[model samples]
Target chain A: AQSVAQPEDQVNVAEGNPLTVKCTYSVSGNPYLFWYVQYPNRGLQFLLKYITGDNLVKGSYGFEAEFNKSQTSFHLKKPSALVSDSALYFCALIKAAGNKLTFGGGTRVLVKP
Target chain B: DVKVTQSSRYLVKRTGEKVFLECVQDMDHENMFWYRQDPGLGLRLIYFSYDVKMKEKGDIPEGYSVSREKKERFSLILESASTNQTSMYLCASSSHGWSEKLFFGSGTQLSVL
Candidate 1:
C-alpha cells in the first residue's frame, strides 16, 4: 500500500525566517507527490506537485519542495515565511497506476510575526 | 476558477441521527472524493466516485456511504452519527488522471453531541 508521512506534528517559525515542513513517502512504483495548505476554516489548496520533472518544484505563495529520490522524501520549503503562512500542511502521493491518493498525517506550521 | 462547494460549513447533530453532507463541483471532473480531517491524523478518505452512480470505498468507510447520481454532485451519508465521527469533512474533485490535482471545498465542521 502507498503511504505518506509527515514526521513533525507541529513546526514553529518566526516571520521572514526560512520554514521547512518535512514529508516522506513509501510506494511500490513511481510516485506522484503533492503538497497542500489549509487555513483555519478553509479547505486545502494545492501547493505543488512532483510527477517526474525537476527535483526542485516551485509552488504557490513562494513555496517550493525538493523531491529527493534516494531519500524518498519531498520536503516543503519557504525561504521567507510570512505570518499568514501559518496553516496546516499535508503531503499526498499516488502510485503511478493507482486511482486513490494517500495523504500524510499532516504538519501544522505556525509562522509568528 | 474551479469551484467545489460543500453544502454546509458547520453542522451540529445528536447521536443516532442520520446525517447527509452534500457536495457539488462546477468543474466537470470525473472524480469526486470525501475525506475527514482530524488533528494529527490529516485527511482520511471516506469515499470516492469516478462516474455518475459509481462509488468506491476509500481507506475509512466503515460507517459512511456515498452517492453520485449526477455527474456534478456527490453526497456522503452517515448511517448513524457518533461522537467519533465529528470532524472536518472536506469534498474535492479532480479530473480523470492520476496526476491531476484536486480542487476542494471550504469544508464542513460536523459536531456530534
Candidate 2:
C-alpha cells in the first residue's frame, strides 16, 4: 500500500516569510504525489502534483513542491507566505494501478501577520 | 469551469436514521470518490468508483456504502447515523490514468444528533 507521512502537526510562520511543509511517501512503484489545501468549512483545493519529469512542480497560489526520489519526499514550498495561505494541508500518493490515494494525517499551517 | 456539487452544505440527522449524501460532477470524469475529514485524520477514502456501477471500498468503509448509478453522480449512504460519523464529507472526481488532479466539491458538514 502506498502511504504518505507528514511529520509536523502544525507549522507557524510570519507573513512574508518563506514556508515549507514536509512530506514523505512509501510506494512500490513510481509514485504520483499530490498536495491539497483545505480552508475552514470548505472543501480541499488541489495545489499541485508530481507525476514525472521535472523535480520542481508548481501549482496554484504561488505554491510549489520538489520531488526528491532519493529522499522519497515531496516538500511543499512558498517563497513568501501570506496570512491567507494559512490552512490545513495534506499530502497524498496513489499506488500504481490503484484507483485510490492514501493521504497523510495533514498539517495545519498558521501564518501570523 | 468544472464543478462538483454536493446536495447539501450542512445536514443534521438523528441517530438511527438513514442518511444519504449526494454528489454530482459536471466534468464527466471517469472516477469519483467519497471521503470523510476529521481532525488529525486528514481525508480517509470511504469509497471510490472508477466507472458507472463499479465501486471499490476504501480505507474506512465499515460504516459506509456508496452507489454510482450514473457517470456523473455518486452517492454515499449511511445505514444508521452515529455521533462518531459526524464529520465533513467531501466528494471529488478525477480523470483516469496518471497525473490525475482531483477536483473537489465544497463538502457537506454532517452532524448526527
Candidate 3:
C-alpha cells in the first residue's frame, strides 16, 4: 500500500525566515504528490501537486515543493514565512492505480513574529 | 470556485445513536470522499464514491457507511455512534484521479457523547 511519512510533528520558524517541512513516500509506481494546508476550524486547502513534470512545483501563498525521485521525497518550502503562514501542513501521495491519497501525519508550522 | 459543503459544522450525538453527515458539491465532480481527521493521525478515508450509486471503502471504513444517491451529494452514516468515533469528519470532491486536487468542506466536528 502507498504511504507517506512526515518526520516532524511540529516546526517552529521565526517570521520572515525560510521554512521547510519534510515529506517522504513509498509507492508502487510513479506517484502523484500533493500538499495541503489546514487552518483552525477549516478543512484542508489544496496548495499544490506534482503529477508528471517539473520537480519544483510552485503553489499558493508563495509556497513551493520539490519532488525528488531518488529520495522519494516531496518537501514543502517557502522563501520567507509569515505569521499568517502558520498552520497544519500535510503531504499526500496516490499510487499509480489508486484514486485515494495516503496522507502523512500532519506537521504543525508555527511562524513566530 | 469549487465548493464542497457539509451539512453541519458541529454535531453532538449520544452513544449508539444513528448519525448522518451530509455533503454536497457544486463543481460537477465525479468523485466524492468522506474522511475522519484526528490529532496525530492526519486524515483517514472512510469511504469514497466515483459515481452516483457507486461507493468504495477506504483505508478506515469500519463502523461507517456511505450513500451517494445523487451526483452532487454524498452522505456518511454511523450506524451506532461510539465515543471513539468522535472526530472531525471532512467531505471532499474531485474531478477524476488523485492527480486532480480535492476541494474540501469546512468539516463537521462530531462528538459522540
Candidate lDDT scores, in order, read 0.95, 0.93, 0.95
lDDT per residue for candidate 2 within B1-113, as digits (tens), equals: 78999999999999989999999999889999999988888899999999999999999998899999899999999999999999999999988864688899999999999
Backbone collision count in every prediction? 0, 0, 0
**Error at A48, model 2, angstroms:** 0.9
Among residues 3 or more apart in sequence or in different chains, the pairs in candidate 2 whose N, CA or C atoms overlap within 3 Å are none
- Which parts of model 3 are misplaced by more than 4 Å? none
Q: Top model by DockQ, which number? A: 1
Give the i-RMS of model 3 in Å: 0.9
- Tens digits of per-residue lDDT for model 3 on A9-61? 99999999999999999998889999999998889999999998889999999
TM-score of every model versus the real structure? 0.98, 0.96, 0.98
Query: Model 2, stretches more than 4 Å misplaced?
Result: none
Question: How do the residues B1-113 of candidate 3 rate in per-residue lDDT, one tens digit apiece?
Answer: 99899999999999999999999999999999999999999999999999999999999899999999999999999999999999999999999766799999999999999
Predicted candidate 2 versus true structure: per-residue lDDT over A1-113, tens digit per residue? 77899999999999999999999999898888999999987789899998889999999999999999999999999999999999999999986566678889999999999
Q: What is the full ranking by lDDT, best candidate first?
A: 1, 3, 2
Return the TM-scores of chain A for each candidate in numbered order.
0.98, 0.97, 0.98
What 10-residue stretch in candidate 1 chain A is worst by lDDT? A94-103
Give lDDT: candidate 2, residue A83: 100
Model 3's lDDT to the true fold?
Answer: 0.95
